[model samples]
Target: MHNRLHLTYANQSDQEYLSIYGKAKITENRQKVDDLWSSFLKVWFSGKDDPNLALLCVTIEDAYYWDQKNNKAVTIFKMAKAAITGEKSDTSDKGTLNI
Candidate 1:
């Protein structure tokens, strides 16, 4: 498993939107996103049975297929899976999942 997860916007518009939203909504909780992913990784690597794993996987799958129009979400899910599997993904210079 990787140690970090890097999120990149799918396009300039998406990047700008996230920048604005982050500044406005997450200004006081900048680490909220990172913390959430960190917790997810921890649970994933715990080696113990986690009932939520199935739900989480299903949710990601749903987002990838149902939200196909949202390139950002698709990229995130793809990269996240690659990170967990220690496999090289098709991720380009566009973005990355550090962990």
Candidate 2:
């Protein structure tokens, strides 16, 4: 299993990245199961009290965020725009947070 993943969150400005890093753990805690119960889970489970409900919990090792980060489609547009405008293709605002 992979021990780490690079999580990316969209932020409008460089100072707004909401990224977080950690060791991922999974659980089926009943309290958590009930709190986040959704109709989607009903497709596979009997109900909130179903014994199969699983929740993802993480032990954060680090976190970071980047601002002005665009999703794939937007990034493509930025590249195209740069091609036409002769301006530097800006993918996003760069920033980092280690926590």
Candidate 3:
């Protein structure tokens, strides 16, 4: 179960939302609310029992990994450095994995 999902990481999959509680309840899992609860949330919700609180379930399938990869930050840095150094960047071995 997840709340306040800012983002999801899945390629080539359908998306769905499972509201834990009923439409009016807002939040079905009190433990999740407590677990993810924060003082900053008070600004959005009255409290843990706030009617607006809710949980969402995410499902992922058919995910694949890159065959080869470079550190994203390092890759960007290398690209930038290549521009200044006039040297080729080590940008190779990248593709969807078979398994």
Q: Pick the candidate with the highest lDDT.
A: 2
Encode model 3's per-residue lDDT on 1-99: one tens digit a residue: 433323324332222222222112233878897898899988888998877777765432223333224555666888899999999976544333232
Q: Give me the displacement of residue 83 in model 2, in angstroms.
A: 6.9
lDDT of 1 by residue, 35-92 (tens): 4445546645552233342211111111111113346777788889999998876633
- Candidate 2, residue 51: Cα displacement in angstroms equals 4.1
Which portions of model 2 show Cα errors greater than 4 Å?
1-19, 69-91
Q: In terms of TM-score, which candidate is stronger, 1 or 2?
A: 2
Residue-level lDDT of model 2, residues 15-96, one tens digit each, is 3557777776678678777688889877999998767766777777777655556676788899899999999987866555
Number of clashes found in candidate 3: 0
Q: Give stretches of model 3 more than 4 Å off.
A: 1-6, 9-27, 62-99
Task: Give the worst 10-residue stretch by lDDT in candidate 1.
Answer: 57-66
Cα shift from native, residue 86, model 1 (Å): 0.7
What TM-score would candidate 1 get against the native?
0.25
Model 1 residue runs over 4 Å out of place are 1-11, 14-70, 93-99
**Number of residue pairs clashing in candidate 2, backbone atoms closer than 3 angstroms, sequence gap of 3 or more or interchain:** 1
Q: After superposition, how far is residue 42 of candidate 3 from its true place, in Å?
A: 2.0
Which of candidates 2 and 3 is the stronger one according to lDDT?
Answer: 2
Each candidate: how many clashes?
6, 1, 0
lDDT of 3: 0.54
Model-by-model lDDT, in order? 0.38, 0.72, 0.54
